[model samples]
Target: MFENGIVGSLIMIAVGIVVGFFAGFLYRKKIGESKIGSAELEAGRIIERATADSEAKKKELLLEAKEESIRTKNEYEKEFKERRNELQRSEKRLIQKEESLDKKMDSLERKEEQLQRKVDAVEKQKEELAQKIAEQKDILEQLSGLTREQAKDHLLESVKDEIKVETALLIKDMEAKAKLEADKKAIDILSGAIQRCAVDHVTESTVSVVSLPNDEMKGRIIGREGRNIRTLESLTGIDLIIDDTPEAVILSGFDAMRREVARIALEKLIVDGRIHPARIEEMVEKARKEVEVMIREDGEAATFETGVHGLHPELIRLLGKMKFRTSYGQNVLKHSIEVAHLSGLIAGELGADITLAKRAGLLHDIGKSVDHDIEGTHVSIGTALCKKYRESDIIINAVEAHHGDVEPTNIISVIVQVADAISAARPGARRETLESYIKRLHKLEDIADKYKGVEKSFAIQAGRELRVVIIPEEVDDASLTILAREISKNIEEELEYPGQIKVNLIRETRAIEYAK
Candidate 1:
C-alpha cells in the first residue's frame, strides 16, 4: 500500500509540476505583452511631445525673427531720419555760409572800387594843388618884386601874427566857457552832496560844569586846607575851580579825559560826603577806571555806529581818546563820525570805494589824539601811527593829504579831504576867537586885493568866501578864471585856515551908450 501510494503521489507531483510550469510560462508571456504595450504607449507619447515641442520652437523662432526684423527696420528708419535731418542742417549751413561769403565778397569789391576812386581823386587833387601853389608863387613874386623865399617868409610872419591873435582869443573864449561849465557843475555836485548829507554841527568845549546840590558841596569838594582839591587835581590832571557863583563847580583841563575824570571824582566825593585826601584819591582812581571803561565803550560805539571794523586794539583806544579831544571847540569824535558819513555818501555818489573812503575819513584825524604829547604835526603823527598799524597805503595817503600836506594818491584820498572840509567848514561847525576871526577875514580880503585886476575885495561868509570885483578892461572873462585860481592858490599856500576858501572873481563890462 505504501509503494502504490508513492507511485500515485509521484505521478500527481509530476502532473502538478507540468501544470505549474505552464502557468509560469503563461504569466511570463502576459507580463511581456503588458510591458511591450506600456513601452509602445510611452514611445508614442514621447514622439507627440517632441513634435509639439518642435512646432512651438518653430513658432517662437518665427516670432523672434519678426521682432528682430521690426527692430532692425525701426533702427534703420530712425538712422535714416537722423541722417536726413543732419544733411538738411548741413545743407542750410552751407547755404547760409555761401550767402555770407557772397555778401562779404560784394562788400570787399565795393570797398576796393571806393578805394580806387579815392586814390584817383587824391592824385587829381595833388596835381591841382601843385598847379595852384606854382601859380600863387609866381603871382606873389610878380607883385612883391622879391624872391619866393622872402615873400613866403613875409606872408608866414603876417599869418603867424594873425593866427596867434586869433588863437589867443579863441582859447580865451573856450577857456571861459569851460570854466563856467566846470564851476557850475562842481557847484551843483558839491551843493547836492552837502544838501543830501544834512548833518548837524556840534561844538563842544573843554570845560565841564558839574552842578552841586548846594553851595556847601563846593566847600566839601575843596576839602580842608584844599588838600582834597590838590589830591584830586594831581590824580586826575585837572583844575577844580570852585567859584562863588551858585552851586556849581567847574572842571577845567586841556585834556578832555582828565577833565572828565576830575568831574566824575568831584561829583562822587560830593555825594559820598567824604572830603578827605584819601577819599579824594580813591574817588579819582575809581573815576579814572570808569573813564577808561567809558573811553573803550565810546570807541566801540563809534566804530559800531560807523559800521567800521577790523581796527587794532590800540587804534580803537586812540579813537576813543578822540571822544574827549576837541578841535576849535568842535568834538573830534563827532567831527570824525560826520566826516565818515559824508565821505561814504560822496563816495557813493562819485562811484568810489565807500569802505576805504569811510575808513580814511574816520582815521584822518587820528594823529590829533597824540599830537599834544608828540612833537609833530597831526598829519605826520597820523602817518606814523597808520604806518605803525600797517594800514593800507591809500589810508596813509588819505591821512597825510587831508590837510593838503601831501599830494593825494587816489580818489579816496580826495574824497576824504572833501568830506573833512565839509565837516569842519560847515556853518557853526567850529568856533574861533573874535580877534583871530577878524584877522582871518582881513587876511583873505588882503590876499584877494593884492591881485592886479581886483577892483574891490570883500570877505564874506565868515572868511569862508572871498569875493573880488575885477576891472573888466584889465581882466577878461578868461583872465577872471585865472585870477580866481591864482588867489585860491595863494591862499592855500600862505594862509592857514580851518576849511577851504572860495575865491570868487567877478568881471562886468559896462557899455555906457546913452539913449541919445
Candidate 2:
C-alpha cells in the first residue's frame, strides 16, 4: 500500500508541473497578442502621420506653382509694355525723318528754278553780245576802208612786223651777251694754246736739187746715151733736168719720195765713180734701203717726240711716208705734229681727253699720205684706214669730223677740229692761188651787196673782214644788227672759208648845206 501512495504522489507532482507549463504558455501567448496590438496601433498612427505630411507638402508645392505663374505673367506684361513704348518712339522718329526729306526736296526744287533762270539770263546776254560783236566788226571794217578778211590780214601783218622787230631786238641782246662770254672764253683758250704751243712755220717745196762737186759731174750723170739718167728716171719715177744751171742738177717729180731716192742714188754713183748700169742699179737699191731706214727713223722720232705709243708697224711706216709728203706748200708731217701739240694744249684747257685728242690730231691728215694713191677724200680714207686698223669709233669719228664733213660726236673731236683749224690758219701755214684769193674777196663783197640798204661793201684784211656800208635812212639802229646778222648768215651759208670772218657794218649820214 505505501508503494501505491508514493506512486500517486509522484503522479500528482507530474500533473502540477504540466499545468504550470500550460499556464506559462497561455501567459506568453497573451503577452504576445498585446504587443501585437500595440505594434498595429503604432503602425496605423505612423501611416496617418505620413498621409497628413504628404497632404501638407502637396499644398505647399501648389501654392509655389501659383506664385510662379503669377510672377511670370506680370513680367511678360511689363516686357510687352516696354517694347510697345519703343515701337511708338521709333515710329515718331521715322515720321520726323519723312518730314525732313520733304522739306529738303522743296529746297532743292527752288534752287533748281533759280539756276534755270540764271542760265536763261546768261543765254540772252550771250546772244546780245554776239550781235554787238557783229556790229562792232562791221563798223570797224567800214572805218578801215577794208573788208573783214583784209582787215584781219592787215592786223596780222602788223602784229607780225611788231613781233619780228621785237624778236630781232631780243636776238641781238642775247647774241651780244653770248658773244661776249663766248669770245672771252674762246680767246682765252685759243691764245693760251697758241702761246704754249708755238711751232715754227716751214714751207716745203716739191722740187729736189742735187749739187755736183764740179761741172764735169753733169755729163757723167747723163751717162752714155743717157743710159744712167734713163735707168735712174725709170727706177725712181723722176725727171733729171740737166739744165744750163752750172754745178747743179734738178730732179722733178710729183712724188717727193721718188725725187729724194733719185737724188741719193745719183749722188752715190757720182761719189763712187762707178756710173755703169749695174752700179747705178746697185746704188739705187742702196739709196732706196737707206730711205726706208730714214723713214723708219722718222716714224720712231715722231712717236717718241709726241709720246704716242703702240702704233701698228704699218701705221708707223705710213706716218713716215707723210714726212716726205706735202700739201699746199706745208709739210704734212710737221703740220700733223703741230696739230697734235695744239690739240693736247687745247684739250687740257677744255678739260677733254688730251691723249685721245692728240692722237686724233696727229692722224687727222694721215689719209693725205696715201691720198695720191687712194681715190677718196682724206676724211673718208682716214676713216676707212682707222677702221681697218681696229681703231675706236671715237677716234674714227674725230678723224672724219675734223674737217666738218660730219658732226663732231665728242668734245675731243671738237678740240681736235679747233686745233687743226688753228694750225692751218696760222700765218704762212698755207697758201692759195691768186685766183682763189681774188674770188673769195669778190664773193665777200657780193654777199654783202645783195642785202637791202647796203650801199657798198669792202673785203679787207685778206678777205677776213667784210665792211658793209648801210643807208642810215633805210636801216635803223634797231634793224642794223638784224641786217648785219643776215648778211653774215648769208656769207656763212654760201662761203667755204678757213678761220672766221668779221662782219663790220658802217652807217653814216652826211648832210651838206651851202649858204650864200
Which residue pairs of candidate 2 clash? Answer: none
Best by TM-score: 2
In angstroms, give how far residue 418 of model 2 lies from its true place. Answer: 0.4
What TM-score does model 1 achieve against the real structure? 0.45
lDDT of each: 0.86, 0.87
Q: Write the per-residue lDDT of candidate 1 for residues 1-82, one digit (tens) a residue.
A: 9999999999999999999999999999999999999999999999999999999999999999999999999999999999
Best by lDDT: 2
Q: List model 2 lDDT by residue over 328-382, tens digit each.
A: 6668899988898998899889888888888888888888888889999988988
TM-score, one value per model: 0.45, 0.46
